[model samples]
Target chain A: MGRRKVTHQLISDNATRRVTFRKRKDGLLKKIYELTVLCGLPACAIIYSEYKDGPELWPNLNEVRSILNRLSELPVEKQTKYMMDQKDLMNKMIQDAEKKLEKEKMHTRAMKLGLMAGSNDLITDTDCSEELARAADVVDKKLKAIRERIKAVEAGAPIIKRD
Target chain B: MQSSNVTDCTMRKRGTKRKIEIEKRMTKQQRSVACSKRRPTLFSKAADLCLLSGANIAVFVTSPDENSDVVYSFSGYSHASEIVDCYLNNKSPPKTTINPESAKFWWEEPDLYRDCDDLSELRIIEDRLMRTKKHLMDYLEKKEKSHSVSKSDQNPNNDSGSSSSSSQIASDFGQNPSTLSPSSLKIVSFDQNSYSSLEPSSQVTTCFDQNPVFSVGSESSSDQSRYLVNEDSGFVDGLLCETEEENNGMRLPQETQTQPMFTEEDQSFWENLDVDDVFGLFKDDNNLEVPLQDHSSTNEDDELLIDISEYLSEEAMECPCFS
Candidate 1:
């Protein structure tokens, strides 16, 4: 096992605070310095602590007030929804299509196996109870496709079945 | 005395006005207008700082919806990727070995094969599958019976099929009935030993008049000989229409055929049919496809506190009913 040695570096809080204030102040000024420098305006900023005096006072206080105002103003809430029905409908259609695709495959296999050709034309040609037979044909065609597909796939490899 | 009283009233009014202004300054709502004014100044100052100091600052503000936040970043100036890199470099964890039962065994590069514990699932599946398949076969047969009679009923001339099957049916001697499995090579015999609950006749009868069938044109020639020839003059036209329908089906790819909207289909079906006859035929018969009505309504905040079992049980249990 390899253990690495640790090193400690310390700076006094008062010193760090002084350094931080100086750095942040410089940074803030550096932010505004561009505009002030370009405009060549003699602008000075003075920040007075609330803890120091009975009455609070700041010089070039408008800038500090503006910064504070900007920070405080931000929007929070946004939009959300469930849309359960549309989601369910989409899922159902997907399932329906999958089932149909499988049946068509199976029917084709059965046909190849010298079985009956379960073509939808069976209903149309018959001049049957038109709508009822048509609907049945739709279901039959869907089932046949699914079965043929299942058989072909199962013969070759793994077959995934939907519950 | 009158002059002194006037001076006192004027001073009191001025004091009240100053108090109101001070109160406005204390409230955040009152400060909102000032805040609006300050935001532009802040943006300008930030842009100026970037241009002046040559610090590559990137400030982004996102819509409140997302975790994508306002990022005021600098590549070298502020920490971004460097902190994560430091954290990662500090300690390297070894990969842990997976348990044999875990799904990871299937995903790893090396093949670690194990027999599935639930071999019983196969038998259960096989049983269900056989039942379902039997149902399907029965449905198809029922559909075929209904299909033949339905056509003959609609257009009586259609009875003169292209083959001798009809004559054989009318003869009433069950000497050579239709093959149990239309496909002769491989037949899945219904085993009477295991489950006698599933009857072929029961399954076949269910499909009658409920679901009709359609055919593809290429398959027409193969089955035309199966139909019995007719003595009537109208029989020839019926066979021709069958061929034409088969051709129509052949023209469109299965999925691409755009199903007409209900209003459109309803109109067309009514327009083509002898309304009295169509209604007469289906008056007592149950339909194959019972359309399920859409329950969704355009309602806002129609929230109901339903029990989990009533609404979401199908999905939580992974049951097929919901699907």
Candidate 2:
């Protein structure tokens, strides 16, 4: 009967997840309604659930569209500026990822080099040494590919969708 | 027997109250159900806030699945859009950052920029077309009004119906098929600038060649000119003025002046669009007009009555066919 606090993560169990979503969604809507009523502010909410046929909008669809239409009237330069800011953040993330990947690659390379120099301390089983080397090669290739993708995204290039 | 078994079943209850972890992946159905249930509660809260404080607030949410959005407004006697317009009007140079809470939910998220691009493109075209029509109506109305003082002088039926329909068709045709060409983009760009400066109007002929879609390098340029026409003709100003008068014992002439200038028909058209169909907004322009009598006057709400009469008179003034 005790109510224990849980983390705000997605629930994994099917039944629990469904129940949690329902309870939390209701709580959120209640908060929104209270904010409007107590503050007398003009507020709207659009909730789209995957299971629903269409999005569940608060108040009405017409009102939301009208607000969106007004928001969209913002000058093109302003919107473009917002996009540019996003691009900048993306580029920064890519750079950080690249640095992390470089450090990892060097560490892996050193281990392979040490193994080749007959440093048996790093490898427990002598029989699978070749396999270990091959696995490291595959990892290196995957990292390289990921870096390339990061570059492409930074350049505003269209990403090729993988089927 | 059930009480004795409680110790053995501790695991069942413990599992239900397990500690929360980091963001975990959720099933599509779970996510959907969560959104659906939470959405209504938010609106009810908004409604309550409006009634208690007499403050205007708008909440907008865009669903990830259907790419649809919902808005809740505590506008009281005023339409939601008018409240937003007043907000925007009061803050002309909107900050570079929009709503902080909603920013993450914006359709233009970096990964989803393509969809956002198409939508803004459509909005630009729609905004341009609205302004053009407004100007055309203005010119035609002025000419008609000057030529004859009496409403009986003009051809009411054919002109009102045809002009609106023809303009809609003309804009639709002009944008879609020839969107690739640069010449059309150039004309629209020119009009966009001139429109901002309050030039009398753009040449209607320039509209025939203008396109909404842009080529790669021109995104920044097009984005700069994407100033949407303010849909509010100052209805909020009038209402706000009324509010201020009750509180301050003095009248605000400036705000009152702007509302009546828009003419009743234009106000009705705008309001109806906000109140009516979403998908039908762009397509069905003609049939949406409800009879004037349909409006509520039961509470003897003088303000509502005045608004209705303004619309009726504007409709009469525009169409000679109507008695």
Candidate 3:
């Protein structure tokens, strides 16, 4: 019969623990070696077992240290400073939005107060729409003027106005 | 007889279903044997993956012994540390997120955000003012230069009309005359000295005078120069350039815009990997097995004769999805 499936966990029994440790450790190293060879990747694993006085280092200690040293030498930005700058930018944006909201609120309040003082009558949708329509007409006229000026500039017309 | 066979089969099934209880403790011999077996298996798996997908890995495990810590290291390359370094180097600089230290309670908060917002708005206003001023200065400089040059080329009788039109054009470009004072004057003087230093020859000056639009776009051109230096100092330039691009309606090149997105994609790949998932691939029974040759044989021949091209390519194809 096939041996029972192995679940990865530590062994508590002294004899079993020692046996499992040796088998698993060897298996781990073999797997590492196979993966490194088959995939053509640079890989290393360091295993220290209680059974051995010295740790089992694949491809040796000097090489691993050099790899680690090269990693440490890389220029990565300081995490703390990066976080701080982000926070500052976000806070600034939030504050700007808040100020804009406050200004809008104050403007609405002023408009309401002015209307109340000017007349006892309430403002209707028609009045608001008429005012908006007038604003839109003015904006459209300005847009047309800007467009014409741009076209004139493109055509190399001599400048007539100073402002 | 058939009933007896069925009962026997049932008993076998029950025995197989029984949980394989592993002892909590192990003897010294068993631990040694297990460690030796597992260590080799781990290295082999690493080697396989490395060959298949061109991945680099380093595993370092420290086990506490009776006397001292035992260090076991497996590496795909000759030097294990190099792979470790490669792994570390690939990491993106810490992402900019919330900083708890800078956060204050509502009562303690100041008007710094609004102040910053105003300052930024002022900067944009200042920048536009500077551009207009630069354009005016260029026009003035050009007019003087053109007049001097055209004196020989064209009739001096028409100078009044042409000079008037040019001055009008320069003045028309600016919305507010008051914006010319204060910091803009400082920028104009600074720009003139810098511009003069860059092109001292009369020929270049005449060429610049011909293209007034060039001076209008000089702000972004100057910023692009700063961008090269900003790359060395983290992503502040990136943020600045984005805002500038929005204001100017300019689009950065495709390569530059797509680069960060690619790095972010890679970040997800690394961040999502767990230790269990990493080793689970090796434990897969269905995977193709490569024969474990003696280490001595491999050492004797510096090069491996086994051509894993077919298997490597197949595995390589599958790597990106898993990674």
Query: DockQ for all models, in order?
Result: 0.01, 0.04, 0.04
lDDT of 1 at B253: 24
lDDT of 2: 0.45
Top candidate on lDDT is 2
**Candidate 1 per-residue C-alpha lDDT over B49-71 given as tens digits, one digit per residue, 9 for 90 to 100:** 32223222222111121232221
- Name model 3 segments beyond 4 Å from true: A75-163, B1-323
TM-score of each: 0.15, 0.19, 0.19
DockQ of 2: 0.04
Q: How many steric clashes between backbone atoms does each model show?
A: 34, 35, 129
| lDDT against true structure, model 3 | 0.44
* Weakest ten-residue segment in model 1 chain B by summed lDDT: B185-194
TM-score of chain A of each: 0.21, 0.43, 0.40
Query: Which rank order by lDDT, best down to worst?
Result: 2, 3, 1
Q: lDDT per residue, candidate 3, B1-323, as tens digits?
A: 99999778777895466542333224555545545555444544444333322223346433313433234554432344443433445432222122244555432445524556577776875687678789889999999997888775775555455444434322443424334222211111112324433422211111122322222223434433211112211112111112233222222222211012224445555565567776436454554233332434333232323455555766786777645
Determine which window of 10 residues in candidate 2 chain B has minimal summed lDDT: B250-259
Ordered by TM-score, highest first, the candidates read 2, 3, 1
Q: What digit string (tens of lDDT, one per residue) describes model 1 on residues A22-107? A: 45445655533432333322222222211222211122446434422332343322111111122333464578789999899667
